[model samples]
Target: MRGETRTVWPAARRVAGGLALLGAATVGYGVYERDAYTLTRREVPILAPGAAPLRLLHLSDLHVTPGQTRKFDWLGELGRLVPDLVAMTGDVLSHQDSSAPLRRALAPLYAFPGVFIPGNNDYYVPKPRSPHHYFKRHPGGPHKGPALDWDGFAKDLVADSGWRDMTHVHDVLTIGGRRLDVRGVDDARSRRDRVALVAGPPEPGADVVLGLSHTPEPRVLDAFTADGVQLTLSGHTHGGQIRLPFVGALVTNCGLDPSRARGLSRWSAAGPDGAQRMSWLHVSAGLGTSPYAPIRLGCRPEATLLTLVPAR
Candidate 1:
């Protein structure tokens, strides 16, 4: 009886160990394949929806490395959703020299009307540092600003893709009876932006006005809101890149509170009666990272789908 009991015990222990190993592998796969698996949903309000609902696709931060055709294919798949208009809020490429690949990746997006703004990464190359070195303080925090030539890059992009260049400019377009006034600025950290390029007290006839920026700095958002822009889109913070389960994102690069760092939030202005008039602010968690900094822990990159619901 003792020998038979011992034999059973060994078999049970072996099965338990095998199960544990399998569990570990499963968890590892879940984390590694997170990018391909995760999709986040966020709905934003469009004040005056025209005859039919308009779907807008917001794509941001494709920090592409050279030879990443797979990433480009994923971007092309975005068209499958049939967005009426698309907005790109910067960091389209990791290196200024690699703009060609970013252009190629965005070629599929040209099927619809698209507007673009550049992030610091596109114009200001981060100094080379160790793989996990982003945690360490920059000691001086980059006294010298972004070195890229904005005019040249903007020109090349326009010529190459035929997309509207929203760098320090404003333009209006009509989409199904709704007029979209787009006001955009260059990266704020570098002071390359000038609000005057797109300044105005909102045109009386437009349904909505969009304010664009790579970083959602308070001053920048204020400028647009003061101008009566109804909505603002930004994507400099990678949704804190690594988010913890219930606690959410660890850090947002800007001054925005962590809760408002990545999704739909409300920005309001007070009227004569002291009632708050609000607008929708949508920030994408972004799609990729700089080639040098390649791993994203808890946050999966995103392409936001903002469906315009008429004011109820």
Candidate 2:
């Protein structure tokens, strides 16, 4: 009996030690994932014939807080990519005091032409909630946190940086010698999007027609697809922030599927003549997590550099 008991005690000790090691590793990994900044590059063949390739940098969901030097450094480094255009899909702030740091970080990219649309977080700050709640469907209710100064945010990002504000409006621009017809709406998650304002087919003779929004809400995508927009870009889901390996995002928080929470996919809708039209969609995984829940797992915070090549 003594011999048997001694053997069992040793085995139990080993098991306890292993469990403690695993727990420590998990916590360390969570910390690492939160600060891991990754850059993703994708080649999208969506340009018209005879058009030159356009290099576009897509940025979103910075969730910038004061004194986050790593994130600020990463933003400044992005300028080295020298993209033809920059598209920012909001959630650019988290704390009221973050504006100055955010602007300084983005100063390098101001040299390039860019467009921006506001997200829900841009208009209102985020409040703390249970991390587990992120995996469930978002409950619609009154927003938390104090109201943000969206006008000032826009002035710094749009006016000071010389970037275009595409909120509920359409514009035509000549980018890299190709004509682009771009239209965008405010965030649909906050019910701020007025899709009717810019709902129409692409302008004639436009080399490329693109749509931009903060959330990849289906209704807005449907409207853009119906209007013959060839491509749409957005961010807001954060690629679930804590995805699983192979399983991917747990919840998109919007109409988009979990599989497409972060990357490119095709969006289709029925036209007036009962014909189906398809458009390319790109949803950025984004750069930062909500300040309250700062840890990430399999999903690394990211910004995407997309090369737009001519389609066959």
Candidate 3:
């Protein structure tokens, strides 16, 4: 009996130690992944000329709720990056009344010039879910309410942040005689894209042209390319949000190939006269999960840092 008791004690001690180590590892990984695990990527021969490289920061699909302290802290810390300009694509709030919290969450970005567009999630979605999925998951999946006040939210966002309301519009950024034209459309999920806004290229002498949309639909992509836009930045699919190591993305919402689901992709353009050109396309993975679906598995949220260099 004494001998058996000694052997059992040693095994139990080993099992306890193993459990403790596993718990520590899990906690450590959560912390590491929670902080901005930024992946740096680039495209050389970026089509700009004779100017110092301009740094453009891109963030999207925030879905910020009422009390996301971590997200606010992260945005505030972004002031350390000192980017020349910052742009957000859409879905700023998880719900319409969340505008107050969204404003507070975005206060840090006020230090720099910024632009924003609205996603389908913003305009008609309820507290926990967007209207985009209303019919798909009927019979009561997660959401338990009606739509929201989109007009009031839109007015407040424009008034508070002074953001460029690029819903079917364009704006230009100038530095040392070179120009970067930016054009955007509303959410493709809501089918509000006005392709005409992206049909005309800025007049000659524009150094770079960028297109913005909430989703990466191919029709809009082709239109932007047709307009002589050199780049397009978008965020919607969450980069599959829970990518597997070997299998890659489980799903991609748009025509974007699974390989180009979250990061930079290259697109070729045909000139109005029929000559071919090339450009870069970057898609941010996004910051927060939909309120109805909280918890990201593999893909951590990201803000992209795009350094646009002159063609060599």
lDDT of each: 0.73, 0.88, 0.73
Task: In angstroms, give how far residue 117 of model 3 lies from its true place.
Answer: 1.1
Give the lDDT of residue 22 in candidate 2: 97
lDDT of 2 by residue, 113-195 (tens): 99998888987788887666787677565547998888788887776798999998898878767788899999998889999
Of candidates 3 and 1, the better by TM-score: 1
lDDT (10s digit) by residue, model 3, range 79-186: 677766687888776765678877776777776667777776776554555545522312234442456665677677778877677788887866445676889999
- In candidate 1, what are the lDDT values of residues 1-312, reduced to their tens digit? 999999999999999999999988755754464345234556666666444666788888877667776677787777777777888998776655666776777777777777888887776655555545443322234522346454576677788767788888887877766788888998874566687788876766777788899987766776777677778999977777767788887566666667776888887765335555677788888987755555566677888888766766
Preferred candidate (TM-score higher): 1 or 2: 2
A best-first ranking of the candidates according to their TM-score comes to 2, 1, 3
Which pairs clash in the backbone of model 2? none
Query: What ranges in model 3 sit over 4 Å off?
Result: 1-47, 126-145, 175-178
Give the C-alpha miss distance for residue 253 in model 1, angstroms.
0.9
Clash count, candidate 1: 0
